[model samples]
Target: MKRNFLLLLIFVLVVIAISEGIGFQSIPIGKFNIGLLPLVFAIIITMVLGIRIFRKGIIKKIYSKENVNFASKYLIFIMLPLMARYGADVAPKLKEILSIGWVFLIQEVGNLGTVVLGLPIALLIGLRREAIGATLGIGREGELAYISEKYTLESPEGRGVLSLYIIGTLFGAIFFSIFAPVLLDLGFRVEALAMASGVGSGSMMTAASSTLVARMPELGETIRAYASASQLLTSFLGTFTMVFLAAPLQKFMYGLFIRGEK
Candidate 1:
């Protein structure tokens, strides 16, 4: 129990720091680029605390049924908006909110939203259920590819899910492209604004903006920074969002697709 509380605190602190526009360079870990020193410190704190808690058998306690239920409710309230914001960003209204400095809070929540919202969306769009098996990067790419191939369903169902992913990605791309100008107009350093918003969108917006930056080298660092931060935020936020929404989404599934059958 203590471990979970401490870990959550550390994560919240990191979120606060990222929101406040603080970051630093660090050693890379394979495919992942490490963030600022404070991030490193926070990670270390989490690791140390987690190890300590493990020795005390607190994890089991934290995962007890009652605690899990409480955590689930909290996750629903916090994570739903996060993902909703992420999926709906292809417009000006969201950008306007960022310009006023709501980016930090929204971005913080967004890191948790993708999974909360992404998985349910994936299920509804009919991605063969196997694609989501790879959602957490828990298994190998070959496994997901194999599952998708073996469970190939009707062409129409495949197309439908693909269409949903397409729409989601399009919204992410358009939101960043349109918002870039707004940030520039607001006198925010292009890279900073990009970094902030990209994190919120799970780096899906990075390619769109990076292409734009490629045409203008002056924006390279900003684009790189945005991509880096966004990717990290996405991994962490997306996973937590999934954990948070799992229960609620399960209930939703019966209502939307399995009504009266079960």
Candidate 2:
């Protein structure tokens, strides 16, 4: 009940932020913005775990198989980028279907850029291949829900998962922000490639990426238009990919690692 309340509160706060246009415009700390929404969500999740730990004392017995399962699912944090890329790729179909026209493409390209920058890092970190599909939300929703119900991660365990996600996402972002310029200087920049492949199912990230890319001069005026075009393309296909692929991938991973465990 308490956990549910916490989540509800966080949802309310997010709604308020959206309605009021409150955003991460102010930098409170280095590399960490004073965005109320993301921070609130992160805090609420942590609070749930803290409360759980306080209520139920620690258990010493280790279930290595279960731990592996948790760890593998924990890797779904990588979806942060995949979602962006997917959103980028599906935007065009959205424009045609909704008649929103050509303006939505910027968001898509930036989203793809973010994905290209982030997914490779996730792969490098030894994330399970099946886990990657889930992170991208590729046919994984029902499976994730099922896994969440059957293999409950207590608050303490959940805290670890959230932390892994936060760390992984931040590292991926920071690496991209810092290294992208260096790569550009070496004439090896792949911003367009990133823009093409990175945007996934997350519209918000795609929009954010579009805004960021628009500020870069090297992307060219035509490129800005293309980014918007790409976002439109991503929004349509990405959603379908998520519906079809997420579950089977998770099951495949389970078979590979947590075989026959209850």
Q: TM-score winner among the candidates?
A: 2
Give the whole-model CA lDDT for all candidates, comma-separated: 0.45, 0.40
TM-scores, all models, native as reference: 0.33, 0.36
Write one digit per residue (lDDT tens) for candidate 1, span 1-262: 5667665455566655753454333334554332333323333343454454563455445445555566635754665564454444323333443464444434555443433555566657765443333232222222223234644434433343344444443354444444454455556666555655454333245533553354346755545545444544545554454445532453455346545642
Local distance difference test, candidate 1: 0.45
For model 2, residues 1-262, the per-residue Cα lDDT tens digits are: 3444454446546555653464333333543332223333343343454353443422111212353355356655855676455445445444442454333444433333222443345445655432333243312233234334544434332333344444444343333333333333445434453344234323233333433343354654333344444444555644544344433443454455545642
TM-score of predicted structure 2? 0.36
Q: What is the C-alpha RMSD of each candidate to the true structure, in Å?
A: 14.7, 11.7
In model 1, where is the ten-residue run with the lowest total lDDT?
Answer: 134-143
Model 1, position 74, has a per-residue lDDT of: 78
lDDT of 2 at 144: 38
